[model samples]
Target chain A: MSEPPARRRLGPALLAVGWLVLLLPPFYLSAFWLQTGLFAMAAVIAAIGLNLLVGTAGQLSLGHAFFLAVGAYGYTWLAGSPAADEGLSGLRLPPAVAFVAAVLLTGVAGALFSPVSGRLRAMYLGVATLALVFVGQHILLNATSVTGGFNGRSVPPLTVFGFVFGDTDDGLTVFDVPFGGLERLWYLGLLLVAVASLLARNLLRGRPGRALGALRDSETAAAVMGVHPARYRAAAFTVSSMYAGAAGALLALVFQRIVPDYFSLGLSMSFLAMVVIGGLGSVGGAAAGAVFVTVLPQLLGHFADRIPLVVAPGSTGTGLDASDAADFLYGAALVLTLVFAPDGLAGLLRRLRLPRPRLRAATPQTSAVGEPAVGDTLKEQTL
Target chain B: MSAGIDVPELRVHDVTVRFAGLTALDGVSFTVAPGSIHALVGPNGAGKSTTFNVLSGVYRVASGSVRFGDAELTALAPHRIAALGIARTFQNIVLTRGTVADNLMLGRHTLTRAGFLTSALRLPHVRGEQRAHRERVREIADFTGLGARFDTPVSLLSYGERKRVELARALCMEPKLLLLDEPVAGLNTAERAAMARTVASVRDALGLSVLIVEHDMGLVMRMSDEVTVLDFGRRISGGTPQQVQRDPAVIAAYLGGATDAPVGEETR
Candidate 1:
């Protein structure tokens, strides 16, 4: 028998809607909103990666920002002019190469740290990962040549072949809209996020992904099943770090300059918050959570004067400023989401959908609660 | 089809396991023949589980060696041991978070060749391998009576169903020697019988040896080709079920019914 019509149509329907949403921002969103969308896209990519590592593999890492810094700075140094700083020497490679290299560099860095990552358990791994942040911060601050030290450095705009993401001498316009930096980047960011999401989803659904989930649940069990826990953990960490690298490179491009402060512990925590609030193990949910977390502060800051009981940054009579308000809002949201729905927003969405047939009777609610099915009796070889 | 390697008997020679001041297994030795069901029965703390652990490469031998085929298992890592055709289940269910199908596919880890990058790229080869493995997983799940619950999360299965899933998962490894720890520990009489039948059928169907660490003496007596009894970290007896059952030392250590009663009458 064929699948029900509704079930068959669901895939195309979801794809159609996803495409529409992805295409709408460049046409309708203002530059300010487009910039916000770009940041959200970057976060979406990173959060999906983090979910794979922290949620799927059950390895907690607190030094994601270290990899972000590596990506941002790696891109800047690789593509920018060597003479821009005292001892800094840029390879002056293509921005696209620089971007890809930056991501791979982060993977290499993660691989380097696998000695600790592969050996440590969840809580201890997290603690060990924290060391990456401190050590990264020290290098970024002291290595004035490569990182531009405390002041940071200017990022070279990404140029793919001949078409620059940045504005050209004869600035291009499409239809009635100006295709400036944000508009051009809107498309680029959209493509990257789409690819990233697809890849992450694909990874999670496949054999390796299942292996990772098994490893997370029980190392001994996973090992017996021929899953090398340490190897998988290291691979997950490296992949996740590479995703952070891509996000960092994108962020550097959007900001037009890079700073060590931008890739701080706070940034790492915000990424964690995104995954947690969106739903830990769901890739699509991570994107939604990323958008929510990234846009809230930007939106509040934009409408700071109008928002009730909220002031702009640097205001003296702050009940709560825009940034602080965003923090409080998301903090409360995180706590409420966890308490109300441990699975996060994705779980809530699942519940909102219409219940399907008894195709899957193995949900935790119905599982293992009562007597074995009568049909199962025949299969048993009771002594 | 997997390449043919000479399936050799597993020999444990004077293997000792010590944890700080306590010795979990003291000079325990036994051999499991090719394609035969070997039962390891002992009271709690008699080192039955420890023997399984040592054989499966989870515990290091304080002395002596374990030979599987020609390779020494005692020196290899757990996963390496698994790759060398030994797979085991836990005394406690150690299923990962996923549907019954997902957990079953995890058992195919050692068999699959695609790595992370190939998988991430969704290469044609990876896709093909995945389809082939999924087909096998489905068939195995069906064989183990879990075909209907392929997509069901393991956590939702009843304890008995979960135990079957665990067995199905181990079978997915396509091991030369299967290690089942407490396969029927929490099962009822009928379920225990069913489990015993399943294990025997699996051994026959897969053409592999079975090493079962079970508390249920009745199931062991019925299912095992050979039985070994352990008591207080020492081998008390070894022979066929009838021989081990009638051994005086086995009776003294277990059926003698000391204060720390052996897993005896209740199981029988």
Candidate 2:
């Protein structure tokens, strides 16, 4: 069936408007907002990857933070110059190469776990992956020469083709606004998010996505339709790990320091929260969810003094801490989303967009003459 | 709608399967000639579904072998069996959540070459391949009389329409052998007649072998060229509908040996 011309054009028009809106943030927003946006962008990339595995492929993972740590540490170790005095070892590779390599390294880590990931299903796989986070924490804490142990290591400024993402004496300015590390990296984050979203959207709308969707619905049906369950599961996990790696690398650049404690089980849970709260399999929904989860805590912390019943960090009072408040809000959101809109925000948005009840009546009558009216009645019954 | 690949004879030789301590199928053997309709008929728990599972590699056989052309199907994985041009529909409708076109495109999985990377990148070749497949899928949907519902989401379709979607999806594979499990089990009389017509036309037009597991004897007798009857996991009778209709053992197994009349005569 042909869609209305206006409706067909609406998607691209809205997309263009969104891109324009995102482009203005670096120029107009303060450093705090820019940092939060960058973190959200990173989350968006990771959440999309996780959604592919958990939502689309129907594989559950609880060790996404392990892969992210792999990416973060992988980049730091590869790009940091060796410091003999501190007993730190590094490859001192170019920042660009290190960035790409870090992602690949996480993919390799995921591939290494494929024997277990490919065999296990749903909750079993989640428990298996939970071990990765603990194992990763142990390595990060003990690997003194590579990871810098308890104190953590400072992240090297990302330099690409003689241009640095960090502050430079060159004093680069555009439209009378000084562009520092955050501003420069904002564009980079945007580019990466765009590419990641496009790639995910393409994948989900194509042959591989359908195969994975089929697998999620029924393994027997998927297999009979020529989709290898284990192979696809492994592939999805590897891809997801690479996405987490990229996010981790970007996060390192944003945070300006790499710490083992930050890449804990809590981080993985937040990522899971992002995808689930957004919508299981929708790319846009995951991005929105990531922004909501990442930005809410930071915003609460920023405005905690003004907002009643919420206190700033390190403050002891009768009120809840900002982080706790953020947690409570999203936990309630998760519950509400599950109860009212089980398909998540994406499905909710779709229902709002379409006049579904009316459309059933509006459907064209195409049955041949003398045919029984069984289809019409059945449709009504199902509805 | 004829596939370019040659249809292959499906030879099940003394196939036996057991789950735990229970034997689900014991030494059941049947051969489906190329370009013919073969029906596997039995009462509930008579191992019809078990045999279908075995043939499709969902379940491993305890003994005996199933061969499609020269390939030994018993040792291969399910996807590998599908790759060898065996496509099937579940007894219960198992259509994925999407438009009819999406489900039909899934049938082309064995035929299409686009992988995760190319699909993610939306490479030129992937688009071309999808367009080509979409055209053929639409044609198959028309063949199944689901042309009007091509773009309709499967959730919106009636039960009979969903069954047709499954059939169209199987046809999209362009398989040499099609396995249908209870194709018209839940359809109304009119819908059942329409489904029978579609099955007959698909076999006639595509010239592919079909092994059907059906509870409806009227549809089975009217459409199938040969019938294999199972009783308590054993092959009790095998022949044309008329031959099996008169077999005392077939009648006894169907009616619990209470009468000598042919099975399903009253229902037919």
lDDT of 1 by residue, B58-145 (tens): 8898998999989999998888999998989888777777688888888898999888888888999999999999999998888777
lDDT of 2 at A162: 87
Model 1 in CAPRI terms: which quality? acceptable
Which portions of model 1 show Cα errors greater than 4 Å? A1-8, A84-88, A316-318, A354-383, B1-6, B257-268
DockQ of each: 0.47, 0.48
Poorest lDDT segment (10 consecutive residues) of candidate 2 chain A: A364-373
Query: Which residue pairs collide, candidate 2?
Result: none
Top-DockQ structure, candidate number: 2
What does candidate 2's lDDT look like per residue over B1-268, in tens digits?
6544588799999999999989999999999999999999989999999999998999999999999999999999999999999999988788786788989999999999999899999999999999999999998888788887888777667777888888989989888899999988767777777788888878888889999999888878888999999988999999999998989998888888757677665452
The total number of steric clashes, by the backbone 3 Å criterion, in model 1 comes to 8
TM per candidate comes to 0.93, 0.95
Compared with the true structure, what per-residue lDDT tens digits does model 1 show for residues A285-379?
Answer: 88888999999999898888998988888888756789999999999999998787666787666555525643344222311223344334324
